[model samples]
Target: MEKDKKIKLGISIGDLNGIGSEIIIKTFEDNRMLEFCTPVIFASIKTMSFFKKHFKSAINFHGINHTDQIIHGKVNVLNVWKENVSINFGDEDVKIGSYSVKSLEAATKALKEDAIDVLVTAPIHKHNIQSDSFKFPGHTNYLAEKLGGKSLMFMVTPTLKVGLLTDHVPVKDVPNYITSELIHEKIDTVYNSLIKDFRINKPRIAVLGINPHAGDNGVIGEEDDKVLRPTLEQIKSKGKMVYGPYSADSFFGSANYKNFDAIIASYHDQGLIPFKTIAFGHGVNYTAGLNKVRTSPDHGTAFEIAGKGEADYGSFKEAVFMALQIFKNREEYEEYSKNPLKKAPKKS
Candidate 1:
């Protein structure tokens, strides 16, 4: 790979009924973005046209059947569907749901085929997009199965990084999923992501407890004391810097996460509630531990603001930049891995 070459960023046009196309159009309309990488949007001309007209967007698109036709300076649209689809602005429809899957299907296939370097997925309607094809909870699980890696639903920002042990499961089922082995696997994934993905040297990880006040040391729950305590002790003995079982209420109130490199939450809302509350429109949901780099905006499809042009593009735009940066960071990490020992600094 050449250092000066631009990375090819692939984008899946999630749920057309929502704001996916609008944000994609608005993000590319900013000419300054072309300087970073060429973007290939996997959607049909009809969908892009619907958004461009509805949003009064000014971005120009170069449509082609294959990725080889990608134009560096224009928004490139890879036509996945041939028929002209109707643009149902704000409601969920069966036909639109199918197209969302098709776009993601085509994008992931291209990613595996090496047509694109990184992927930035737009938000999708999880319930509507469910089919025999996409049976997983969200992008993290689907990509984990598709790309062959243990996926971590990592929510990231400039200062904070959080990974989930249970993604998209019911609150009642979270405790059932929080076991010793699950703790080790997910926390190890988070620890590895901190070093390889974020370039953190000797990263420190914090673990969030499941029950209230981390089970109040068995007064409220037994799993935190029996399972988490022993597992964390074993992990600590393995020469890793990890701590916690911290109470969720006080953890965020004082911003205690600032002291660690990463935090492992027992479940989705445990970590994401605070993360979204703090960085709602600015955070990035990174699918770490996959062979390919994939990210999405922290927020979901804004059906209320579908065509209002009121949806903020900050999170999606940040997802794009974060993908490119991670691609570069992986390169540096690989080179560093080859030679971990830094030679003594040359005498000035």
Candidate 2:
């Protein structure tokens, strides 16, 4: 796995019309970022140049047509193609969608072929990016299918870690999807991710209730008691430190999250609202349970701020660092898991 060498971070250049190139350029402008890993952005050099005209940065890059040409300590861009379409920022054009898919497909192919060590994806406009080849809600679903594993949309920050039981679904449909089996699968993914990716020894997790006020003891809803609580009980009895069915509203207000390694939210907003509120500029959306490491900035494609030189690169930079760290941690964890110490002979 090239454990001794510096990591090669494969990046997908989200939507060409968005602020992806801006943030990516800003993140790698300082030479300090290169010391940890080599950044190979999967995009066209022309799109990068367009963004460079808007943002004033000293970020220089090396253009290559193939992944094998990647060089350490440089912003190596593997241009997917010499894009023929005219550049137009902030518009959701089909041309942009096709090119974005090319970037994603190429980057993912590199990841699967072991050409790149980790992947830090940029944001995409959901409506425009949909096509015959891509039919999932977002990156998490697409990655899960390609990478082969149960996907868990985990939002991570320094203080809090939140995983979703159900992701990228409608608010009304959330209840029907949250079954005991789904809870077990998501929580198990979180527990293992904490141990291997984040390097936590024992990951104690909390689950937020599905109903308001935790069903108010069934006065508000029935899922909290009938489904969630019983499932958690079984999980705890089976040797995992899992707990909850706690009221979601008050859970984050009191900062009770500090007491646990991670929290499992019933749906998207129930977890993301508080997380983005606290760590919007730096939060990382990590797709756990995938065979390979993948992470993204918490925010979406900033169409309004495109080419304005005002895009914040904090979250994107954090995503890169997070992916690198996870790659290292997983390597160490796998080696540790593979071999155990032998018992010494008893003294007479």
CA lDDT, every prediction?
A: 0.86, 0.87
Cα lDDT tens digits for candidate 2, 1-348: 675578999999988788888889888888998889999989877767766666767778889998889988888989888865566778888778777788888999999999998999999888878888777778899889899998899999867899999988999999899988998899889998888788787778999999998898999989889999999999999999998888999898898988998999999999999989878999999999999999999999899988777889999999998898889888777776676353321211
lDDT of 1 by residue, 162-258 (tens): 8888889999888888888888888888888777788776888988888899998799988889988789999999999989788887897798999
Per-residue error at 155 for model 2, in Å? 0.5
Candidate 2 similarity to native, TM-score: 0.95
Candidate 1: segments with Cα more than 4 A from true spot: 341-348
Candidate 1 minimal-lDDT segment of 10 residues? 339-348
